[model samples]
Target: MIPGGKSFCTRHYKKVTHCLFDLDGTLLDSEVMYHTMIGQICEKYGKSYSKDNAVQIFGMTDREVSEEVCARTRLPLSVDEFERQLLDLARNKLPIAPEKPGADRLLTHLFDYKVPMALATNSTEQSVRLVSIARPKLFGMFNHMWTAASRTRTSTSWRRVASRTNPSPHNASCSKTPRWACRLQSRLACRSLRDFKPELFGLPPFNEAPPSTTVPIHHS
Candidate 1:
C-alpha cells in the first residue's frame, strides 16, 4: 500500500508479476517460540533475554540469533551449544506454531490466481520444513522456497527466484515484516498482510474489503 497511489509504483517499480515472502513473522507466528527458547537458554546461564533481544534477532538466521543471544546476554554456552538447544526447542515448538491471521487468506488468493510466489527467508531449510509441516497445503503453494543456509548469494537468490517465477527483480515484490530485512532494490515492508496491496504489484487483489492503509516501500 502507498499513499501516493499509482504514481509511486509507476515511477519506480515495474509491474510485479511474482511475489517473494519472508517466513517467520510474515507467514508463521513463530517469533514467540523463538523468544521463549532464547529466554530459557539465557535463564539457564543465570542471564536474561527480553523482548528487546527478540527484536534484535528479528530477521536473523539461526546461527546469527545464537551468536547475538550469546554475545548480548553473555551466556556461558558457545554459539554451537546455544544453537543446538535452540534447534531442539524449535523442533518441538515450531511445528505447532500458528499462522498469522491473514496468512492463509492472502496466500490462497495468490495461489488461486496462479501468481508466481516464492518463499525467500534467512531461516534454515530444516527450520522452514518443521514450521511448514503442519500446513503443507498452504506452504506448498510457493513456486520456490529458499533458505539462507543453502550458501547461495542473497541477491542472487532473489534474482534466481525472480527469473524462475517472474523474470526480473523489477517485476517482483518482496514482503518482509522486519525493517532491517527490506534492503533489496524492490522491497515492500508491511506490519500485516491486510496492509499489503496486491494490485499495486499487478497481482490480483483480495476479494474482500480493500486495505485500510498504505505501507512503506523501500527501494535502492
Candidate 2:
C-alpha cells in the first residue's frame, strides 16, 4: 500500500460515490512498455528516441504520437503505417505490465463499497485490452469503460463518453445523469497519470470538504 493510502481513502470516502479512472499510467504500469517499444522502433530506423521525446508524447493519442515521432525523426513510414506498427508492438509488450502502486487497493475498496466507477482513457480499445489482459477481474469492475477508438477519434467525443458515464456535478451544462454525487472532490494529477487535470473537463475542484461528506475520486 502507498503511504497515506488508508487515511486518504477514509478522509474522502464519504464525499466520493463515483470514480473515474484513466487506464494507462493511472491503473496499469504500461507507459514504460510503450516507451521501450517506441524506442526500439525508432532505433530500427536509425533514429534516436530519447526520454525527452517520450515525455513530450506521454499523453498523446496513438496517431498524435506517431505523427510526432515521424515529424521528429523523419521516419520513412506514413502516420497510418506508423500507428499500425506501433500498436502491433504494444500488443506484444503491454500484457506483461503490472498495475501501478496502490491501484489495486483503491479499486478494490471502491468495488467492495459498490461505488459507481468508470474508465475514461485516451487509449484505443485494442491497446486497452493489451494492457488489461493480465487483470481481467480488475478491469471488469468498472461500471463503464470508454476508449478513443469507440467512435470518432476526437477529444470532444471522448469527453462526451466520459461525461455520460461519470457526469460531473460541477458541470451544470452537462445533460447526462450521474449515479451519485458526493462532496469530497479528490483528483490524482501527477506524472504517472500523465499530469491529466479533470477540472479542465468541468469536473469538481479538489477542495477541503467538511466531515459530513466526501467527494468523488477522479484519476488520470
Candidate 3:
C-alpha cells in the first residue's frame, strides 16, 4: 500500500458527496496488459515498442494509439483494422486485469457511504465491459460509467462527461489530464489510486497527522 493510504481517505471523507474515477491506470492495473499486447502486435510487424512510446500513448484512445503506432511503424493496417485488432486482443486480457491498489477500498467505502460515483475512462465501451466482467463487484459500485467511445470524438468530451455526470458542487474527481481533468472542475488530481490525498480535494484533514510522504502525481 502507498504511504498514508489510510489517512488519505479519512482526511477527505466529508468534503465530497460524489466521485469520478479514471478507469485505466487509476482504477484498474491494466496498463501492463495494454503495453504487453501492443508490444507483441508491434513486434509482429517488425516494429519496436519502447518505454517512450508507451508513455506517449498512455492516455490515448484505442484509435489514437492505433494511428500513432501505425504512423510510427509504417504498419499496413488501417486505423479501424488496427483498433479492432487491439480491442480483440485486449478483450481476452482485460477480463483478468487487476485493480489498482486502494481502488477497492476507496470505492467500497464511498459506495457504502452512499456517495455517488462514476467511471470516466478513455477506454471504449467494449473495453470497459471487459473490465466490468473482470471486476464485477467493484465496477458495479459506480453509479454511472462513461467512455470516450460513446461520447463525441473530441478532446473536450471527457470534460463534458465529467461535468455532466457530477453537477454537484461538492463532487471530486481522480484522474490524470485529457481523460477526466481537461476542463472539468475537480477539487483534486490523483496521479494514481494509491497516492491520492482526499484532503486536497476539500475534505477535512485527519485528526492525527499521517507519516510524511511523497509520490509522483502526474498532470497534463
Candidate number with greatest TM-score: 1
Ranked by TM-score, top first: 1, 3, 2
**In terms of TM-score, how similar is model 2 to the real structure?**
0.67
The TM-score between candidate 3 and the true structure equals 0.71
In lDDT terms, how accurate is model 3? 0.69
Q: lDDT score, residue 86, model 2?
A: 92
List TM-score per model, in order. 0.75, 0.67, 0.71
Provide the overall lDDT of each model, using Cα atoms, as 2-decimal numbers: 0.74, 0.65, 0.69
**Candidate 1 at residue 153, lDDT?**
36
Q: Compared with the true structure, what per-residue lDDT tens digits does model 1 show for residues 7-35?
A: 33344444555677778777988878788
lDDT of 2 at 187: 32
Instruction: Please list the residue runs of candidate 1 whose C-alpha ends up more than 4 Å from where it truly belongs after superposition.
Output: 1-14, 152-156, 166-189, 209-220
Question: How many backbone collisions does model 3 have?
Answer: 0
Task: Write one digit per residue (lDDT tens) for candidate 3, span 2-97.
Answer: 011123344443345466677887788889999999888888888898898898887788878999988887887788888888998997899988
Error of 1 at 32 (Å): 2.3
